[model samples]
Structure formats: C-alpha cells, structure tokens
Target: MKIVTWNINGIRTFRGGIKKALDSLDADIICLQETKVTRDLLDERTAIVDGYNSYFSFSRGRSGYSGVATYCKDSATPFAAEEGLTGLLTNHEGPVRCYGDHTEYSTEELQLLDNEGRAVITQHRIMCQDQVKTVTVINVYCPRADPEKPERKQFKLQFYKLLQGRAEAILKDGSYVIVLGDINTSHRTIDHCDPSDIDDFEENPGRKWLNCFLHSDKQEEESTDEEYNEAYKLTSTHDGKFVDTFRHFHPTRTNAFTCWSTLTGARQTNYGTRIDYIFADCQLAEEQFVAADIMPEVEGSDHCPVWGQLSCSLLPSSKNPPLCTRFLPEFAGKQQKLSRFLVKMDQKSIQSEQRNELPGSQEEEERRENLNPSGAGKKRVLTAESIIPKGKKTKTAKAASKPQGSLLTFFKPKITNVLPSTEAPERQKNLDQDEVTSPQNPSVKGSVTKDATLVLDGSEQLCTSSYPKDNDQGTKVKTPHLTSQPTVGPSDTKKGASSGFWKSLFHGPPPPPPCKVHGEPCVLRTVKKEGPNMGRQFFVCARPQGHASNPEARCNFFAWVDKGK
Candidate 1:
C-alpha cells in the first residue's frame, strides 16, 4: 500500500492543499504535520475520506499552532503505549494520579505536549490488509534556531532525548515502525543547497536536536563543535537502524529537496534544503521504495509531500474474487449483426458522396454550367422554385415578407423610452403608497442610497429617460452621491503640514509587544529588519524588557508571533 507524509503547514489554511495532495497521490496511508486544528475544527467529509479512518493530536498551544494527523484506509487506532506514556514527553509536569491500578493509560486521556515549547509528537498505528501487524508512524516538527541566546542548546538536547526514548520503545515492540513527516533536519552536504555558506561550527540548537536521533548511542563521543558534529551519521547509522527512503530509493537523482525558499520561487536553489524526510525501519528495506520531489509544481506550502510504497502480502480473505456470468446466444447474435450493418452503411455512404463530387466528371461539369449560363438565348432559371417543396412556397413567401431583425430589438428603444414615463411613475407611485414597500426596499437596497435604488430599478425596467421625473409629492430632487469622490475635511488640509510627524509615529501596530526571552520581553524586532517570513514576525533579544537584569541572558523561548497580519 502507498504511504505519504507531508507538513501541511496549517490545516484550515492549507485544507485545499491537503485535498489536492490526497487526490494526486491516492495514498493508502497519509501522515500530516502542523495541521494546527483541533478535532472540532476538522471537516469530517473533507479531512477524512469515505473508507478511511483518521486520528489527530493537537499541540497544547492556542489554535493555529503545531499539530499532527494521520489518515489510514483500513481499520487502525492511535497507538496508546503503557504508563500514560504517549510516546512523547513535554516540559510540563506529568499526571499526579493514575486512573487505574495498571500503569497503562487509555488513549483517551493520553497527552504528549511539546517539552521544548516547539512541537508535539503524534503517533498512529495503521493495520494493513496484509495482516503484517501494526505499523507505527510518528509525525514530528522540531524547533528552529533561536538568535536570542545560547540556552536553546540544552533544551534542544533534552527534546532529542525524549524523542529517542520514544523511538526505542516503538522499535522494541518488533513491529514495522515508520518515522515520517517533517523531521525539520537535513543531514549530509547534499541535503542543503549551500552547505558551506553557514558556519557549521556555530551553535545550532536544531542541529543538536537532530543529533539525538542520528547519534543516540555515540552522543558522548561526538564532538560538541557543530563542524565536527556527526549526529545524523549520514554514512552509517541511517542504513543500520533506519532507512533514508529518498536517498535509498532515488540515489541517482540530484536536487531532490522538499523545502524551498518562498522568497526566491526557485526549485532546489540557493536557499532550498531537504528538511523534510520519510524514514522507514530496516526490516522494510527490501520492499521497493519510491520518493517523489513534488516541490516544483505545488504551491501554498513551504515543504512538499514525500511519498513511499512498501510491497507486502495481502491476506487471502482480503482478496476480491471475479464475478461469473454468461451471455444469451440470441441476444449476442443480434448485437453482432447490428454492429456489422452500421459499419457497412457508413462505408457505402462515404463512397457514394465521393463519386458524386469527383472533379472533371460529367455530374460536376453539368452542375457548373447550370450555375453560369453565358448564352443570350438562355432564360433566367428560378432555382428556388425547383428547390422548394410544393407546400413550402407559401410558408417561405410569408417569412420573406417579415422584417429580418428580431422583434425584441426592432422596438427596444421605443418600448424603453415610453414605459418609464407612462407605466414606471404610476407603478412607483403605487409602491410608495404602501409603507411596507419602502421598508422592504431598504432590506433589498442594503447600503445603497435612494438614487442607486432608482437607477438599478430603472435599468431592470429598461427605462431610457435621460433624467427620470421625481414622482415623490413632498420630496425635492437632490444630486446623486458619487461614492468614489474623496470627502474634503478640515483635518485633511492640516495633514499636509504634519505628514512627517504622523509617518514616524505610525509604524504598523507597534511591532507586536517584542518576542519574549527567558520569560521576559526582548527589545530587538527581527521582523522589522527581516520583513515578513511566512505569516510570522520574528524577533531577536535586545535589552531584556522585564525581569532579567543582564540584557544578554540567553534563552530558547525567543520566538515569532502571528499577530493576525
């Protein structure tokens, strides 16, 4: 069965994108990241296909934040591990009490909050028709590099540890585990467009975070320096424990990147990187794998969908049997004869038409001579008399006598010019006589003025008046209000003198309260310097705006805000 993973950005915003992906790929299983929607917001019909079952886990943050969902074609449920452990750990405190004597908790009460305050891990167990047991798929979106301070390094490491523990538990189960979705990490020099441009030695919290999974066993031996950091172990570990589906499936392909730079609009160019991935268990390596770079054609999302297929045996009972039937001899013979007769008729008609129109033939010369007779003795032949059937002559004569133009167009101007003065005024007078009519007109008119009401009504009535007569007995005629004309004001005249003052003060919503660093607001506005990136306003730390005394107190909490732009 085909399986696909995609970071859908926001489910509501990119709902169409999800639908498009599903229609194009038709995958049996789909894992989506950053759905940013709770169960209440999902459309049952649009989000879940008729025969498929879906499960979703939302982030603890407010609406429009990190969330993940999985859609399976067959019967499956969310994998609920033992001990209230939802295969994810967060920075927030765990449950103080247990529901039952057993350490295991129900999936209904399980919660997996994001510890790094970045993203949550959502896992789904899909049962294939092949009865190949359960396939656990985990969707992940990791934290990004924070420029506010250096404390993010520690938090990133902790987040990775939590993920590693979950992975180990899943693998120990001995089922086919597929860790897919946007891992938000790129390994190897080929994964990035310009790997050398950025300093590899610089402290990157996200890179360190990925190392937790890539170098789980050798974390102590790996160098702390980002340059020497071999967390992903591009050469060995991937092939051993996990399989990089893209590299393994499409080895000869180059520039097979998923995430693209929205600013440049180029496919796998300078700013493009392969941050999205689909990692499969080593056991499934022999099964044929396929990875498609769908970034070039699709729009809306920064990361494109990556899909793979696994060949597995289906259970005998699941296979559908062919239907058995027979055709009647009499009906079959009649159908065959009808088909042959039509084909012969078509061929005969084609030959007859061709022979009649042949050039230099007797029939062609005679037809030409009849059309252009040059002899003085030749009489003017009336072709119409010969061509017209006996009784049709009277009908044709009557049709020729009538005017060629349509009846509606012939008297259009006259009808329009006469109706308004004669019928419209009386009809409007009768309408105004009833108090109920004007009130109903207001509801129909919406925000339109009286003149607009009259004009629209007159156009519908096909009135041709240059100036309609005022039918109201008490009201006086007034000039029509032109909505497009600018209103002159005393304040508008003074604004020219104080333009600079207003321009300086009006800097668009005061920069979104500054990004918080270490639980306090930071002064630096990254959005002002960087411009709009996605729909977020990024910020760096300046002097601490609140509790922190040292302006340099580093913290990973410095983040971007949506601000409802």
Candidate 2:
C-alpha cells in the first residue's frame, strides 16, 4: 500500500489546487499537516473526496493555527476515528525540566500536544492472504526548534521523547506501524543542503535526542532460563528506535530536500532541508522498502510531499470502543510479583478478547502495590500497560485518564441548570436564540424537529426549528446539510465561516469561538446523556473539553444552566 505525507501550509489557499493533487497523488492514505483548516471551514466541495473518508483534528486553541488531517480509502477496514495524543505522563520519567517544563507550568506541553492538533493516529484492519492484522498510522507535525522561543525547543524535545515512547507501545501490540510527518529536524548533515546551517547547538540537539530514541544501546528486556519468556517495557526517554524509511531506501542520496524557505526562494537553488519523513517499523520487508520520493514538483505549499509504498499489509479491524491507554513506567529490580500479574492478565484477556473488551484492572491490587512495595510478593501488580491484542480494546492510559486539567470526565455528558425556571419569557427569548445548537448530532436533529417539544417547567427549554421540507406524515422531516444552508463557521475562521456558532443556539455567530475566549462566564452549551442524566442539560468548557491549552485552564467556574431563569 502507498502512503504519503505533506504539510499544506494553508489548506484554504488550495481551493482549486487540492483537487489536482488529490487526483494525482492517489494513495491508500494521505496524511496532511499544517492544514490551517478549522472545523467549520470544511464543506462538501473541499472536505469530502469521493471514494475516500476524511478524518480531521483542528486547532481548538486558535482558528486555523495548527491542525492535521487524513484521507483513507473507504474500502479499507478502519477503526473509524480522529484521535490526538494527549496526557503524556511524567511519573516514571525523571526531571520534567528535561522535557522542558516546571511544576508551575506542567500542563503546557501536553495541552499543545492534545488540543493544538499536531498529531493524529488511526488504526486500520486489513486482510492479507485471509489473515487479519492491525497497523497504526501516526501522522505528526513536531514543534519546530525555535531559538527565539527557547521554551518551544524544549516542547519539541519533549514531543520527541513522548512520540518515541508511543511508537514503542503501538509496536508492542504486534501491529505493524508507519509514522509519517514533517519531523522538522535534519537527522544528519547529509539530509540538508548547507553544512554551515547544521550546527551542533539548538536544532542539532533534536538530532541527538532522535538518535538516542531510535538506536539505544541498552539491553532493555532479556529472556531468562525461567519457564516463561521475560517480557519487559522500556519507559525511559532512550528506548529503541524507528527505521527511517527514506534513509533506509536511499542511504547515500544527497540534497533530497522536502522543505525550503519561501522568502529566499531556496527551492529554486535546490537549497532545502529533508525534515519531513516516513519511518516504517524495522520488521517491514527490506525488499518492500520502496523509494521515499521528494515531490518538489507539487505546488501550493512551501513544503513538498513525501511518498513511499510498502508491499505487505497488517490486516486487522476494530470493534470501535472508547480507548484508555495507561503507559507503564520503567519497572526494574522488582519484577517477580508483577510478572505473576502479567500471566494472570494475559489469560483473562483471552476470554475478554472474545467479548471485544479489555480485562478490567484490579484497582485494589494496584493500590496496594503502589502504596507498599515491601508487600510486593504478597500482593503483586503491574506498573504499566501491556501489549494490546488484535480485535480487542486498546489500553486505558492512567495519565490520560484524568488529563483534563483536573476537570476529569469533562466531556462525559451532564445535565445543568445554571438559571432558575421563573424568568420564562426572556430566558425563553435567549433560548429562542437561533443557531447555537448547530453541531451535527442526533439530539440536535431531534431538537429542531417539528415533534420536538420542550418541558419548560424548569425542564428542557425552547429553540428555533429551521425546517426546509416537512415530512409526509407531517411528522417526517428533511435533513438539511450545514453547507446547502449558509455555512455558520468558526469565530475567526480560516474560510467559509459566514455565520458564527451553531444556528440552533444563538441567533447570530458566537461572540467568541466555542465558548467565550477569556475571563467571565462563557455562553452555555447543552448536553443530553442516557440514564438518570437523560434529558438533562449540562454546561461544559466552550474551548473544547479534556484538552486545555494551559494549567490555569478550565473555568473551574462551574455552574448549571437551568432550563429556566
């Protein structure tokens, strides 16, 4: 299968240009970076490509800032998700400063990693010779090594360590992995055109970190003479490495640039850096290793596209479930008790795998081991997550469990009553506001339907119903696409955002994007969940939950938006 990575500096600029490349660069999957496209900017004309399904992760912190997208063939069996890597834990890893953060600003890097939409991973299941296998395709836009913003360099370094660790985990699942993106670092002098630009300081440090991560000399896990295999996990920054696909194919090729400066017109002189890459797993066939071509010929972006193809496939599919992966720190010196736990968990997973669920953890057992290690032999527990098997649920990560800036379970639906029911007419007036509840969800469609009625005795409230066509039973309704009806896009959108916010909520555009940007109580959003919380309205973070950009994040400014008053 063929795979490609390209950093389309401004996706909007490619209004007419994207179609050209999409047709020419036909591959099984295409990973894009620096899309600069907001959630609201996408329309049928640009977003949806025939015969292919699209997945996007937009920058919630700011409009059109940094985002990533992927387009895969609909024929391929995929887990069907658009996921971002968040909540990189600092428990086992020593010295947070090394990853470029202090206790005061601990959440800085993680927020960027999650909400900024720099990286996205998709798991696809395919069939090879009637055997099914799973493979992870990770597309990342690493933070640049910026000297002016020294902290950014630290952020970049931290990103490298976390990404390297993540790659290790994905591979442990017995899945073939392909990591493609704009790495933004010239791994060696040969990768770049100018030798003087390749200094040992600043950007060069990234090369050192990358080198250590990919080719560690340490013997991480050694099998012993015991009855069972000595399984192990490496949590340290320097673990093992990825096979850089480009270098693997053309080891001696020079001046194979992928990005150049638009200001200096460096592409004209062939003066550019080979920062973008597609790194395949070492297990992949050397013969299947095809050329990593630098397509400088592709126009519409400062960075050119990099393409590569592999012969074999990891054919596997998933029974899509909410995944929680807890990374285990380096567990050395103490292994006997944990080893027993591993054996038990493995056996339990066999039965659980049949159910398409993971083996639930024994929280009590884990608590005991963590509290008193001296009792390790008496009641043992594993510190980190083990390998994720095929067709089974992905691991639930501990750091990621409550990574929501102390706002755990932020996105889980809740019913809120911020106001009282008495002030009906006016509260009804704000409730009658058009276009806010515009997100394309089943509930939204139900709300605007003619049959949808409000229980306004301090219960569910009223809203506008923009029905274009009525049902035959007069109960039936027409589903109007967001675009055919004037597009109500982002607050400060990249393009195509004429109307602000959703039309079902507020009448005009949102005062700010999602929730109000800074200070004070932001606009209220409604949530409908099943169970007791069913038919209830809850208020949540407007800037998108779980991925706060900063520690001072979260309005923590909690209050209910009552159906009345």
Candidate 3:
C-alpha cells in the first residue's frame, strides 16, 4: 500500500481538477496539507471524488488558511476518521477510535490548538503478517515559527509536544502510528541547504525536539543502554520511538530536499530543505515498511510529495464504519448545483399560476361533469353573469372575484417614471402637486402621467418610458418594460455594469505603482508585528508565488503606503 503526503499550498488552485491530480499520484492513501479551503467553500467536486472517500478539516478561526484533507481509495477505506487532534471536535457516530489520553491538556488549550484545522486522523484495519492490526495515520501540518513573533516559537514547540504525547498514547493502546506531512523543521544539518548560514543549529528548539523524539539509529561505542534511557528521559515525554521513514532507507542521501524557497529560485538549483517527512513506528518501519522516498519531479506546489510503501493491505471495511465522508449529508445524495435554486423558483411560479385560476372555473366545470354525465347530446346553457367582462362586473361579482396576486408580485421591484430634467424643467413642481396613489400599492404614492408611464415596483426606483402622443404627427418612442427574466447574454453585461458603478463609488486611495520586476499590480498588506512600523500598510508583488526561475513568479516588490504622503 502506497501512502503519499504533500503540502499542496492550496487545493483549489490545482492546475487540472483535484481528483485528476490525486489520481495521477496513484497512491492508496493521499494526505494534503495547506489545503486553504473553508467548509462553506467546499463544493461537491472537491468533497466527494469518485472512487475515493475524503475527510476534511477546515479552519474555524479563518478561511483559506491552514486546512488539511485525506483521501483514501475505495478498497482502502478507513474504519474511523477524525478532525483536529483534540477529541472535543468528534462528530462521528457509533464506535470511536481513541487517539490516546488528552486529560493531561486542559480543555481551553486543546480547543486553541485544534482551531487552526492542522490535523486529521484516520484509523485503518490492516493485515500485517496475517494478523489484523489497527494503524492510525496522523496527518499534520505543523505550525511554522515566524521570527518576528516569539509567541509563535512557543506555539510550534507546544504543537510538537502535543503530537508526541498523542502518538505515544496510541502506541500504548496497541495501535501503530504513522505521523506524516510538512513538519516545517529540518532535523539535522544534512537536511538543510546551507546549515552554515544558521547559528547554533542544534540549539533550535524544533530540531532539538525531533532529535529526542526519534530513536538514534547509530549506537555509540561509549554509550550503554542505561545511559541512553537516562538521556531520553530528560528530553521527551513519550516512551516510544519513531523512525524517519525516508532517512531510514537512505541515511546518507544529501540534498534530498522536499521544500524550496520560491523567492530565491532555490528549487531550480536543488538548494532546499527536507522538512516534509513520513515518520512511522519503529516496529512498523522494521517489519512492514517496503520503501519510502521523496518525489521532487512534481511541480505544482513549492513543496513536493513524499510517499511510503507498506507491505500491509487494508482489511475490508465493515457494513458500518465509525466515520467517512460518504456518510456526511453533503456527499450522501445527489450533489446540489446552482440550478437547483432556479428549479425551486420555477416551482413557486407554477404554484402562483394555479392560485390565479378563474374564481370558480374548476369547481363549476367539475360540478357540470359530475351532474350531467349522460347529457353529452344536450347543449349547455351560457349564463349572462359569466359572459360579462371581469373589469365591468358589478360590485357583487367583484367581491366574489379571487385575489389576483402572485408570490413574485411581492418581491418584484417597483419602478417609477419621472421626466428627465432635460425634457421637463418644471417636472418636480408638477410631481409635488399631482401626487397619486399607485394602483398596485396604495400605501405608496407618486406622480404619474400618460406621456411618461410609471411602473412602480414597490421600491422608489424610477423607470421612465416615453409613449407616442395621441396626435398622428407625434413620433413614437418605444421603451421596453423590464421583468426578472434570466438571459445568458444580458446577465454578464448587467453584472459588469453594476459592479463598475459600485466600484467607482467606493474606490479608496489609488493603488500603488506596479512592481519594477514584473510590472504587475501590487498587493497591499499591513504589518502585524509589534514594532514602530506596526499596523503600517505596504504594497508587494501580486504575482502567484512560484520559483524565481519561472516566468510567472512573484518579484521582490516592496513599497510603503505612507511614503508619498
């Protein structure tokens, strides 16, 4: 079974379809990090791919940031799935797969850590050496520490600590653990492109944490078993050890980086860091592990994919699994499309047409058919009351008339026509003196005339139409009456016109000048770091992020917002 992990940057921005990209990878299980999509924005195509079951974790704190997703083939469907590392976010029904003890962490701390939607855990029943074993895959996009924010460094360390605790808990529960995704930390000097540039490399908290987490592959001549146990106790909380899968197979493989800096064209020369990894349990790596390696040839994302092969095959799924996207309401049935809402509106219009049927036409016709079943040869008599025009009916007839209202009438926009200032200079004076109640809605009143027809749609919006004078010499000016009829050709034009009007009205300060390198528009950003320039806005290149060698790559554009002021 092949399992792949990639930091996709943004799932929605995939070149072709997301399903096509996943299929091209040809993996039994694929985990994606930095999906950068929210729950509401998830569509059927992305949420429910054919031949695959997916699980997604979306950021509750913000949209389009720090999201992860896992897709498993139909033959390898997981027995259980979960969002967020903390157990508090469980929406799964039936049997639950425990991920270890969370009692050590407070409720508030768990909630805070899980808010970013950085992790998704899945438990699969696999056949390892003829024995059914439960393997928990913890897909995590570890937080990156920003140099400007010291608190983020602590957050990153805390995340690593929590991850270690969870893995150890699962191990104690007799389930093998596989932790994978962008760890965002190079563990050794060999993993980095230029280790000399970084001072006190071993002193970094993230690298130090990783060193203690994984077991030492090489046993020192001077170190004994007792000495190793004592040293391990001082650094880590977890008693169990994990093996870096790729490094386990190729320990001395240098420059085997999975991530590169797009700003400096690092990927072009293969000058990058190997932060992405697939770390498996020590026993799992030693027994069932087949091969593990990185795929630097894939070019869609700044970080390439790393995969691990295992000899174990997933056990057949039971009739009722604890969790799966197929069971979710969004993907259970026919996917909803934009046209579904249009179909509903059409149904409403049909109902209104039925409601507007002649006062008692249906009842009278039914009565005649029932009473004169055998009188087909006899001529039916026509009543004078029925023959009279509806408008000319007596007060009694008018009282008996059914209401002529439809659901659309209430929502229809009211358009009132007023002569333009160029045509009638004193039209305002005449409007003030000759205000008349609207025939449709008497509650609102407006000035109206025969020459200029007023179509009041309830709102005070003016719709002016010129009618030809009664005299034969008068020229005719035809103005079309507007209704809410959807036409493909006009819709695009309407949106363009309306958007331009609103944009001009609310447009703020003119945008900063184009970037010098790419000559593209710049994007505005505000400084969030606490310093003299805190909250200050600046402009940078607007190009899509990519390796500098690429023609479409973002340039080194920078300008202060208040510089010219």
Candidate 4:
C-alpha cells in the first residue's frame, strides 16, 4: 500500500477536476492540507469520489482559511476516523476513542487549539509479518508563525505541543503512527538554501522542538539535557521516538525541496527549504517500509506531494467503514435533488382534472355573469356607485356636502391684497407710535424676531434685518404696492466658463497600464502583508501564475502605484 501527503493550498482551485488530480497520484491513501473549504461550502464533487471514502475537518472560526481532508480507497478503508487533535469532537461516525490525557489542559484551551481545523486522524489495520497491527495516520497543516503577531507565535507553539502529546498517546496504545504534512520548519543547516545568513540555524524554537522529538541515530549527541528538558515541558512527547522517513532514506540529498516562493520566482533556481515531510514510527520504518521519497516535479501547488510505500498489503477491510464518506448524509439517501421539489407531469394533469370537477364551478360562472351584465367580452365602466354598495353613504361624501374643511386647505398658497403706497406712510407712523408707547412684556423675553416680506413691483423682497425696539414690541413696516420695471440678477457667465475644464480633467477612470513583455494590460493588486507598505496598490502581468520555464506564463513586470504617480 502507498500513502501520499500534499498541501494543495486550496482544494477548490484545482485545474480540470479534483478526481482527475487524485487519480494521477495513484495512491491508496491521499491526505490534503490547506483545503480552505468550510462545511457549508463543501459540494458533492469534492466530497464523494468513485471508490474512495473521505473525511474532512473544517475551520470553525473562519471560512476559506485553514482545513484538512483525507481520502481512502476501498482497498485501504479505515475502520475509524476522528477530527481535531483535542479529541473534543463527539459527532464523528465511529466508536468513541480518546487520545492523550485531557486533564492536562483546560476545556477552553483545548477548543481554541482545535478551532482552526488543522488535524484529522484515521486508524487502519495493516498486516506486518502475518501479524495484524493498527496504523494511525495523522494529517496536519501546522500554523505558520507571524512575526508581527505575538499571540500567533504562542498559538503555533501550542499546536505543536498538542500534536506531540496525541502522537505519544497513540504510540503508548501499541499502534504504529505516521505524522505527515507541511511542518513549516527546516530541520538542519543542509535543509535550507542559505544557512550562512541565518545565525544558529538549528537553534530556532521550532527546529529545536523537532530535534528533540525525533529519535537520534548517535548516542553521543544525547548529552543535551537542558534542551531536552525544555522540549519536554512544551510537548509531553519528548520520550516518544519517531523517524523522519525522507532523511532516513537519503541522508545527504541536496536541492531536494518540496516547496518554493512563487512571488520571487524562487522555483526557477531551485531555491527553497525542505519543510514537508512524512514521519513514521521507528519500528514501522525499519520493518515494513519499502521506499520513501518526494515528488518535486508535480506542479499543481507550490508544495509538491511526498509519498511512502509499504511492503506489506493491508488487512481485510470491514464491510462498512464507520467514518466513510459513502455513509455521510450528503452522499447517502438523505439529500434530495432539484427534481424532487418540482411537480411532475402526471401530478400537474391530475390537479387540473380535480379543479374542473369542483362542486362550485357552475355557481362561480353564474356569479361572474351577474357582475358583467352588459356582456362577457365588453369593457365595463366602473363608477363610485358600483365600487360601493348603492344604499351605503360614504363618510367622505357626507363630509364634502357639509362645510368641514380638509388639512390640505391650510397648506394652499394665499393671495396677498396689496396696499396702496399713499397709505403706507400713515401705517408706518402708527406702528412706530405703538412701539414707543407699549410697555415691555416678560413673556416675549426669548422670542425670535424675523424680517417681514415686502412687495416691490410684481416680485417680493425681504426687509433689512434690525433688532426689536423693545422686548414686547417689534419694528413694523408696511408692504405697499409700487409700479416699477423688472429688475435683473447677476449674470452666470463665469460659472459656465469653468465647467469645461473640470469635465476634461475627470472624464472617467484611466486605462490600465500595459506590461512590457506581453504588451497587455496589467492586473491591479493590493499588499496584504501588515507593515508600512500594507494596503499599497500595484500592477503586475495579467496572465495566470506559472513557472518561469512555461512559455505562456506571466512575466515579472511589477510597478507600484506611487512610482507611477
């Protein structure tokens, strides 16, 4: 039997179809990391393959972030499968099984560690030397530590600790373990491209944890008691022994990288670190494994697939695997199709016949005939008497006959009765006398005064603003009608002169910039990394991302928006 592991980056972004890609691998068991699909987004195509059973672990806190899945062929179907490293999920379809001691960590901490959907464990029975042994495969996508976020570094370390604890617990149960996926850390100086640039290459925290976790070949290198004790505090599996299958086979292989940086075209020069691995139990690697290697030539994802072949065949599988995808409700008979919700041809005809045989059919026709008395085809002129019963008197008609007025009457424009200019002088003199003789009233202390409207010719003008002469009395002016010529306002020639220049400056959005190599318009992108240049815009080649050797691939044309401006 053969087992393969790959970080596909995004399962939904596969070219052609997902099944075609899986067939090309030709392995009994395939594990994918960074699936980036939530439970609600899973479709039948990805979930149900022809002869394989699938198990998925989806991220609960985010959609399209971190996820993992495992597909097992019918010949290698597992009897049990469970999601998450915390062993807190109870909804799995298998017998209850616990990994590691849960009393070591609080319930809240365990939930936080498993919320990212990073791990899935499957137990399969395999025959080794005529003895049936249980082999547990743990597929994991470890979190990368962000330098800017201090909390993420802690989270990354906590995940590694929980993973180590569970693997050790499984080992104690007499089951062979195989932990595989993108570990995200280079183990030694030879594994990285430029070891000279990094100070103390093996002194990194993640590397230190890995060194103590794996079983060493030489006894002379086991004197580092202080480092072992530190790793023991973080991961309880410091005593558990496992072998790195790749390095065990090829101890001195160089330029054997499984991942690269597409942003800098690092794959063209083979400049990358060996981070992806398939670690197996020491006894299993020594006894049953035939060959273990990396397939760097495969090119669907930035990280290629790494596989391991076992010498012995799998034990007889059960008739029905407990956690198989075929048993899930999505692939099972529980889900219905669109045709099930629609009415069938026979049902539609039956409903029509039932309507024709109704008892009230004749009475309904007679009622329609009485309503349209003129003719069935003639148009009827609907009147108020027809709409309302003939003997009934509406409240609106009764109110109209009386002198009751409506609210709309108060909003109607009023006609002004213009006073002659001859009487205007006498009216102003009387108002001035009233203001001087009237005593100040305390009730009008805070009242606001407004200017009166004056009529000049046919148009109206407002009087100049002035303070009230007294608190109780206001300065009044009489509006008198005066015969005069129509007066004109200021001209708008200056406003029209500037409109043309403004329209030409902002006609529409500018055309996209063309790339130098392809002579095609470039695509716009924004910086997602957090820093001073975060949220900055840039333009690059429009073609899809591909290797440098591909003739139809994108060119390395990049320009920042600030430089273009």
Best-fitting candidate, scored by lDDT:
3
Report the C-alpha displacement of residue 173, candidate 2, in angstroms.
Answer: 2.0
Q: How do all the candidates rank in terms of TM-score, highest first?
A: 4, 3, 2, 1
Sorted on lDDT, highest at the top, how do the candidates line up?
Answer: 3, 4, 2, 1
2 or 4, greater by TM-score: 4
Please, what is the whole-model Cα lDDT of each candidate in the order they appear?
0.46, 0.54, 0.71, 0.68
TM-score for predicted model 4 compared with the true structure: 0.61
Q: lDDT winner between 1 and 2, please give it.
A: 2
- Tens-digit lDDT track of model 3 for 215-246: 66654202333443444455554434999999
Name the lDDT of candidate 4. Answer: 0.68
Output the better candidate (1/3) by lDDT: 3
State in Å the error of residue 400, model 4. Answer: 33
How does residue 320 of candidate 4 score in lDDT? 45
User: Global lDDT for candidate 3?
Assistant: 0.71
How does residue 542 of candidate 2 score in lDDT?
38
Give all TM-scores, in the order shown.
0.46, 0.49, 0.59, 0.61
lDDT per residue, candidate 4, 1-565, as tens digits?
8999999988998868789988999999899998988776888889888887788887664556678999988888888888889877646557326568777687777877777678988888998888888999999998776656666667778888888888988888889999999888887655777666777655577887787678765432233334434444454434448888887787767778888876655676677788898998899888888899999899977888999999878764675455555666666779666554343334444444434332222112111111111121112234444568644556657756854454533322221322343553465464431111112432211111111111221132221112222111333333222222233221245335455668766664345799999899988888876579988888888876554655566788998876434
Candidate 1 regions off by >4 Å? 14-20, 75-131, 149-153, 201-240, 251-253, 264-270, 287-295, 313-565
Q: Per-prediction count of colliding residue pairs? A: 2, 42, 6, 0
